[model samples]
Target: MTIRRALISVSDKTGIVEFSRQLAEQGVQIISTGGTFSLLEKEGVPVTGISDVTGFPEILDGRVKTLHPAVHSGLLAVRDDEEHQKAMKELGLDYIDLVVVNLYPFAQTIAKPDVTYEDAIENIDIGGPTMLRSAAKNHAFVTVVVDAADYGAVLDEIKAQGDTTLETRKRLAAKVFRHTGSYDALISDYLSKQVGEPLPERYTVTYEKVQDLRYGENPHQKAAFYRKPLAASGNITTAEQLHGKELSYNNINDANAALAVLKEFDEPAVVAVKHMNPCGVGIGTNIHEAYQKAYAADPTSIFGGIVAANRTIDAATAALLSEIFLEIIIAPDFAPEALEILTRKKNIRLLKLGEFTSAAERKPEWLVTSVDGGMLVQESDVHTISADDLKVVTNRKPTDEELKQLLFGWKVVKHVKSNAILLAKDDMTIGVGAGQMNRVGAARIAIEQAGEKSQGSVLASDAFFPMGDTLELAAKAGITAVIQPGGSVRDEESIAVANANNIAMVFTGVRHFKH
Candidate 1:
């Protein structure tokens, strides 16, 4: 299969002209359609139009341009078959030796704020994908190129080898299939919104492979980084460390978790995370004090935890942070002096996220977990329950301080696993019982840890009380009030138990199931 003819059609014409010129210089005839052909012709590159090759006009506003049997027959024909050559000769079809095609900007079109359904539909390429799939299917005979960045490499290969090898063609075909699959997934996800129903099949997600990390949680397991398709620029994947060793899998995960939690606060804030959970979080007038208070919350947990700051890290904050043996630190900016002092840690990761904030953006889909042979997917419990949203089920309304503690407990409980309980007072978590089999056991653990502090502290449950056992435990622990989403069928029993204990209880009408 000598590369005598090639088809080039692309939406992103970044280096197409230079590439086409090089192809023409190599005596390879260029075949293109519409915009691509006009651009090549204007750039003084010889090109044959699709109408001349297919012997049919591009009708229906260019929708029915390249979806012809002649075009596909040329691409799909077997080079080794004598019958294929006879048929091609009879039909006056020229063999398409190479195909350089890229789809329309469907993803970018829908990303526009003012995008309309018609506009998105127009961007969905029918002919381009047809050409790509056709060429990709016959990789043994056709060289398929999808990305513009591959033009230089493809040209070099053609120059060096006279034609792309079968192995390279097969690899390029694999890339084409992956590209089309990702494109189709984006289209399906968007169309699902028009029809008010969950997708009948699995919700498809597309992520570009970013980098292969050293290892996963342990040094033995293999790991890699994948960036989501629609993620904004300057995210962790695109961040430059400037100094320090390459990030580990655990370091990247913890850093992202810390960033996610810290970005929620509008004020200057710092959060330290360990094992995918926030161990310490604090907000102050300045980042330095915030970091100090966050580190002081639990120095043991902050030992190798990931620290994230909402504001730039100054020299003062860096000096204080330098003393701690942290794994990673993420922030919008860092002073030059601060970075110099921090980089001395060698193995510590210093990620600069720049001044990018996506706090108000709609949360990405749901959290998914996989067990043995099945998977569970649900919306993330990042939802906040405000005081005004709570219902005073009992006769006694909560005091201002009690309401604040209850809200604080509610927030903390959402971060814990199901069957969770948290006790809070004076804007601090006193005790927490997370991931227990029984609700009563979780309640007891929270109360016991709170000790005499439970006398004035408030308790928050992730789910409704099943019986009076948890209520009785809270009463004995001297809990002042309790907050939970009321959904249990035995609501009367729980309410009666709360009233008898003389503890104020509020029904949030919203559940915060963390698991």
Candidate 2:
């Protein structure tokens, strides 16, 4: 197929000038509308105004320019079809071999700090998508290009074969639909959110690729990282890497787990996570003390884990952190000498996440997961509990110190896997038992891990106890206090056992089941 004519209209003029110059050099007639026409003509390229071919001036501020039949007939008419060719000739319409178009910057426009509704509505492209769809639907004869990266390949194919091959045309057509689909989805998402529709009947979202990871959870799997177009500031994706190589799949998962735990504390904190679970969490008045307490919580499990700090990493804390072979260290900021000491290890990833701001500044977003044949979407688990929310269901009430520890343990247990048990003292986790078959098994694991430390420590369960066996097990471990969401049929049995052992048990009425 010989190239005869082309149409060019773009919002992002990344490579339109050079690509159009190549097409014009190949004796292809170029037709452009509005700003694109002025740009091409100013750049010394041979181009005709879109109105010249359509014999109609642009109306309604260029919104009604390319919607005319003069342009559609040229793009949709089949050269080999007898009736189509006859209709084109009788109407003095010519064939359009190629279409190069990109939509208006509605996403960028809405992303501004203070954009008006009228501005966003006006930026929605009408002619651009219509032109691309017309050309794409007739891909058997017409070629369409939406992405600038494809310009070189399309130009190369044209130069080599005098036209793009059928396969290349099909690929470009598929690319056009994906571009237009995402464009519409973004507009839909923005409008629905503005109108306070949390979950629309037809929901869609868009994300941009950040980078390809080394591998997924295992080396045998493939993975890449994608960021939402409007991700919250200072999130994992927004963190600036100060040293080390790109993050792996496990690294991101573990770091995310560390951040979730770190967000629960406003004081200086350190959280160590491994295998998508927090191995240890500590809170202190300063970063150095927090590091010491967290390491003391579980030194063996902290090895090769992701560590996140809610305070600036000082020289002393960095010195202690550098002694271990940690996979990643993320903090709000780092001192000059601290970076110098940590950077000595070449394989560790160091990230700075600006400041330790509260999650109240966060915008609403869906937590999505992919199942076999469908997807699941829900809001994030940001529910918080305090001493006031606790109901002293047992006859023996907790002391001041035990109540404080129970509140601290409540925050950490919510992030753990289902059938979870967390043992804590002085805001540091001494033992965390997660993902077990039953509540008793999880409690036994936590109690065993705490050992002598379990004597005065408190236990937090993610859900209600199905029976009183867990309380009996805790009683044997010398657990002083307990916190759980109590609604089980055997609640009185558990309360009786707690009273018998003088254990302070409180019902939070909040169930946190993390599967």
Candidate 3:
């Protein structure tokens, strides 16, 4: 499949003129369309207009330009087939050996802050995708280029062998399909959003690769990070890495978990996460105070965990943070003095995120997780707890101070794994037990971690206790009050236990199962 003729049409004209000149220098005739033809003619590239080959001018505002049989027949023709060659010769159709095309900026068009529906629809490139798909399908004879970065490779191949190798053609064709596939998916997603369909009969989504990682969760596995182009702001994908080493697989996972809990508080707060569970969390008037309390809650767990703050990290806090062997530190901003102190440590990752800034409005987001052979998509756990949402179900009602601590514990517990228990006092988490096999087991772990601090701490449960055993454990641990989603069949028994132990209990009527 020696190169003789090539079709060149591109919305992005990057290197198109030079690429056309190089192809013409190789004695290949260049056929172009629309603005591409005008620019090549003006640049003295010796190009043929698409109308000259099709014998028909572009119509319907250029939407119907390249859909004719002349274009498709040229691309789809089998050079080795007798019947196809006979039909092509009889029909006066010529083969298009190479296709250089890029689609209209549909994604960029819709990204405008004030774009109209009509404007978006007009930007969809029908002819571009059609020609690329056709040329890519007949890749044994026709070479296709959808990315500007591939222009050099294609030219090198042509310069060396007068045609692209079959392997290169296959690689380029696979790339074309992926490009067009993501193109179509973006259009489908945009249109579905316009129609307000969360789950249409058909589904399409795409992610742009950010970088390849050293390894996945374990050393033997390969891994890469990808970002959803349209993901909501304030996520780990959108954070700016200001300092330190590249984030590991566990670092990203733990940092994201910490941020999810950090977003639950508007006050100055810090959340320390280990292995996707909150080990410690605190809220206070300032970041230093919050960090101090969070570190005090579980110094052992916070030693190597990821820390995320809802407020700018001040110098005093940064000094304390620098003392720990943390994997990562994330916040809305870092004071210059704080950065000076923390940057001295070489291995810790520092992420600056504007998403947690006060000016950015918190919006509802969809949570997606991959399963064995399918996927799970649901609304994020943005549901929050407040004083009004609490319904006291025990004979003892929580005092004002006790209610505050219970709510704070409730917020932190939601981010922990299922069968979770968190103990809180003075707006800081004293102990967190997560991912236990049983509620009593989780309670026992949390109680042991809290030590003497567990005596006055209020307890927060991610879900209701199936029996009164967990509450009895909490009571013996000296937990004064408890908050949980009370809908279990044995809820009355749990309430009876709370009453017998003179412990205050509240039912939130909502469950937060992180798993």
Give per-model TM-scores.
0.88, 0.93, 0.95
The whole-model lDDT of each prediction reads 0.82, 0.90, 0.91
Model with the higher lDDT, candidate 1 or 2: 2
> How well does candidate 1 match the true structure in TM-score terms?
0.88
Answer with 1 or 3, whichever has the higher lDDT: 3
Ranking by TM-score: 3, 2, 1
lDDT of 2 by residue, 481-512 (tens): 99999999989999999999999999999999
Please report, as a residue range, the 10-residue window in candidate 1 with the lowest summed lDDT: 357-366
Tens digits of per-residue lDDT for model 1, 143-167: 9999987888889888887799888
lDDT by residue (1-515, candidate 3, tens digit) is 68999999999999999999999999999999999999999999999988889999999888888888988999999999999999999999999999999999998898888999999999999999999999999999999999989999999999999999999999999999999999998899889989998788876778888888999999999988888766656779999999999988878888889888888888889999989998889889899999999999899988889999988898999999998899899998899999999999988899998755331345666667899998888887778767998899999999999999988888889999988999999889988889998988999999999999999789999999999999999888899999999999999999999999999999999999989
Clashing pairs in 1: none
After TM-score superposition, what is the CA distance of residue 306 in candidate 2 from its true location, in Å? 1.3
The residue ranges of model 1 lying beyond 4 angstroms of the native Cα positions read: 232-243, 335-341, 354-364, 368-375, 393-396, 440-455, 467-479, 488-502
lDDT of 1: 0.82
